[model samples]
Target: MTPLLSWLTAVLVGVAPPPPGRTRELSTRDRELLAVCQTDQFRRVDVRIASIVEWRERRGRPYRTIPPDASLPEGHIAFTFDDGPDERATPKIRALLAACGVYGHFFIPGTRVGGPKARWAIAELKGLLAEGHIIGTHSATHPSFTRGVVTSRDRRRELDRGREALEATLDIHPVLFRLPYGEGHWDSEVLFEISRAGLVDLHWNITSDDAKDKAPKEPGFQGLTADEVLARIERSLDFSRRPGERLGHGVLVVHDTNYRIAALLPTLLNRLVTRGYTFVRFVGPLVEGRDAEEDTGVPRRD
Candidate 1:
């Protein structure tokens, strides 16, 4: 087959031919491309020669890049949740936040909303927006954007399709994105794609480690109970340990999909409140005193 035909065939099958002289050490672009070809995003769409041409034209140019601001106040923390809209966990999590009078940034999986098995997810999603919570794309499905196994195209699909899913379901476009597994494997090209997609990359500096139970059964993998998780968070709040560190300021990560998070959040919030950490949502930028403007706050799907 001709090279172009070979490439098309690979995409159709959710694979990307490794670059020439490909090895375990893949270049950033190659890794991004591989991720794009290997992920489930493309398989959900109808691929055609014309569509490929359009993608080529629009590849580097993202169609909502909202950059976040850097002026968060002291004692302010942004609580971000990922891999959710899960029925068992999401509603409880929402109620807890509401009771606490705080908001969270929910990075939702695109596939879960409006999927055959997750029709209820749309309502959960809308409920989040209605209740003054922030939403953003975690991906069409959660995958490591930096893993060598997927391609840049896969990364793009992850960003665009996930946003499209949100816009379609909620009638609001989001510009915030969280790397599925955080920043472990991130590189320049991945950052470029984030800009190309017009998204501000939001990674966390503090963790609740609330998903400890989800860890695989391997070495150094013990689970934490709700009380232990609270203790871990408390330890992280010790400003004396890292004096010059962003004292009283953090982008805290926790997973809503984790049952532990839903169970422990109330306790966690109470502890943080007692410690004087104020909860705030990232609405593109951090507004110092009051809530973010409505345009940047909870969006109405209408």
Candidate 2:
């Protein structure tokens, strides 16, 4: 979903990049295809995948193995931002996270680190490290990991490239990966590749649905007042509830490109806090690549 941030990232051949390529004039057909590909319906393929997963568990094939509460308190929360390290709003969020004294995870683009729009992303990541926030890979170029859709070999190369780039730029080997669009058959082929790369695939408990949205076209939202986008995103938090199931902690996912994200942060954080949720970063062995996450949260009773 955050494909641009992931794909347009820095390459490992020493950050001194080639002269930028000339912009190609895109046809109307190209633009239409781009919009359709980025829509919610296109991404719902992942939802179907998840539903099938939940169903498999119904048939006695458990997919997740949620961790026991090991001296952890109830209502521990974590705020994670994906498709980041932008010179734009990412650092702002990091600063806010720092003020809250909560350690969150930043899933950054490996190649984009030293690039123009996100060169500061590397510095921000360094600051995050100093402040105890964990760093994870969002993929080398943010491409699909689907086997037939994108050759498995290419997926490995891209993932490994990302891992290497993140380590080189940020000086820390990334331990977690949020698959591009959160798509992939996590139990088989994708898992095999992730395991070999020594990284765990991390997905969100709550998504802000920021990627699928296109900015307003008329007058470019020049004088819009208040935080409409944030209000919509706040509604996403409602999806985190699981009735009688102990949902464990929540990791909220949002993009750096959202309009008024900074303005909405205080209100959202305030609401989550009012609900007794405190931010807590992932620290399982799976994230460290010792073993993959058998389960990321508590499953429902059949």
lDDT of each: 0.60, 0.53
**How far out, in Å, is residue 216 in model 1?**
8.3
Model 1 over residues 58-152: C-alpha lDDT tens digits?
45543322212123446666778888876546776776666556778898888888558467788887888888788888778777876632677
TM-score per model over all chains: 0.67, 0.64
Candidate 1 ranges beyond 4 A from true positions: 1-71, 148-150, 184-186, 214-223, 239-247, 284-297, 300-302
lDDT of 2 by residue, 201-237 (tens): 6666655555554434311112133265565555555
Error of 2 at 72 (Å): 9.6
Q: How accurate is candidate 2 locally (lDDT)?
A: 0.53
> For candidate 2, what is the total of clashing residue pairs?
11
The lDDT leader among the candidates is 1
Candidates' RMSD to native? 18.3, 14.5
